[model samples]
Target: MKTYNVAILGATGAVGQEMMNVLAERDFPLNKLRLLASKRSVGKTYQYKDQVIACEEATPDSFEGMDIVLGAVENDIAEQLLPHAVKAGAVVIDNSSAYRLDDNVPLVVPEVNPQDIQKNNGIIANPNCSTIIALVAINKLHEYATVNSIIASTYQAVSGAGVPGLNELNTQVTQVMNDEKVEPQVFPYQIAFNLIPQIGGFDEMGYSSEEMKMQNEGRKILHHPELNVTCTCVRVPVMRSHSESLTLFFDKEIDVEKAKELLANADGVKLVDDPNNKQYPMPLDTSDQDLVYVGRIRKDLTQNNNKSLTLWCCGDQVRKGAATNAVQIAIEYIKQNA
Candidate 1:
């Protein structure tokens, strides 16, 4: 087996660290591994298997001879550094919203659109984590019947906000438990024992930036520009895994039994729809894994037609939503070009 040189941008952060873990866990073929981060993280060291790899300050020159670079940074840093990495002869699978909707960049969900990898112009953007999880859960249904619109509400985990989100939640819970005043930092308000209906800043249309991604990114990834999505994203107190309640409107009728059969065989999805036994998809059950657990499959009671159905799905936001998806894109990219 031949190995390629791989570098992880933003190695000190949560998703960045998970990228390293995914690469290691999957036993990806790599001749070398490089960790890059901000100047303050330059001297930090991260363990990769039995090796201790030190972090390097990311610069245009840092990606000297790498084959692939997995991005796990913010939009600003990605804009500044990724173009140079591409110019330096490396294909980048970026996790930021930076280039997702760029007509030039390809937004990919491996299970849904692996062929789109071929259209990349040196960069393949991973779809929003919630978008990725939602698409994967219902992709087979889309294939069975033409999906026209989606109405979704996401119960996203604190892990979606990275390390700071976790820290803020933990600190607030501790403070509030002791009857002390809680301070909001990473989140706009107290996230412990409460839910925040907003994830990103509100748009003029009253939708948060995160809420809009479901429509915009989903349309791009599915290659269905006509697909319409109305979404509300909430920040829940869970430490990992995001759960979504989705009502899909299809052009054709799809019963609950058939939907279960389709999803049971779907890649990256696990069917756990036994409501009688109390077996349903939950954050605790879906956390630390790649598969999106989908359950509570049933027809929409209010629709009065077979064209619509409702389901719930859960997936580790950090893994499948971020690191794993990018790595899978890199894998598919390698196979097509190799």
Candidate 2:
């Protein structure tokens, strides 16, 4: 079997740890595994298979001789480590906002932009959690019916902000349940029993950076420069899984049955639309699954020519939204390079 030496930066963080699990779960070809974190995390050990490996302080030296470096670190750390990996001849699959919009780095979703892998300058970017989930559900439709516009709203999980956010949510929920008023920290406002319509810092236009990523990243991944999208990102009380309600305007009349059949066969999508039995995709159902569960399909009442279709999609932000996608990019790279 072919083998590759792999490095996972920020392995102690949520996405980093999930990257390790995804690698093992997918049985990625690894001859050596290196886990790197900050100085504060040094000397810590994480279990991989039956062996325990120490976490090293991440530096340029960490990439020496490694074939692939899975950059599961923060944006700042990924910025520092990515170039170092490139200098050391390692292919980097970076899960960060750092290099995503960089003209040189290919922002990729393996299912949509696998060919973009060939354009990598030793670094490939994983799309944002919101963008990844949105495109996965909408791309196939764009192909068949020519999606002209999209209006989407995302119900993001606290976990998107990492472990601290999850802790804050849980703690705040407990306090509120006990009839205590909780203060917000990780989020700008209280998130225990409330929804925060803003995610990431708001730009001058009032759209959060998270909301704009769908249009920016979608164009790159779908190779559709003219595609228009408007999104609202909200932090929901859910601990994991992200849900999106999308209204798509297609170019032609869409047969409802045809759309269902198309989505049922799409890669990484599972259709669960059976409202008669009160069946549809839910965060609770998609928490652990790799596939993007989609349902609640119906033609839009306000648009003609079946130009609109409303649907819901759910995916684990930590899994397909982060780690699994990175691993899939690496696998695609390895396959093409082979």
Each prediction's number of clashing residue pairs: 0, 0
- Candidate with the greatest lDDT versus the true structure: 1
- Candidate 2: residue pairs that collide: none
Question: Clashing residue pairs, candidate 1?
Answer: none
1-338: candidate 2 lDDT, tens digit per residue: 89999999889888899998888898999999999999999999989988799999998789999999998878887876689899999999999989888888999888787898999889899999988988888778878988878899999999898888889999998998899978888998889889999888889989999998998888888877888899999999998799999988888888678789999999989988998999899998888668888889888988666678988999999988998899999999999999
lDDT value, candidate 2, whole model = 0.89
lDDT over C-alpha atoms for residue 103 of model 1 = 91
lDDT per residue for candidate 1 within 250-317, as digits (tens), equals 99989999999999999999999999999999999988889999999999998977999999999999
TM-score of 1: 0.99
Q: Candidate 2 regions off by >4 Å?
A: none
Evaluate candidate 2 by giving its C-alpha RMSD to the native, one decimal. 1.1
Q: TM-scores of all models?
A: 0.99, 0.97
lDDT, candidate 2, at 319: 88
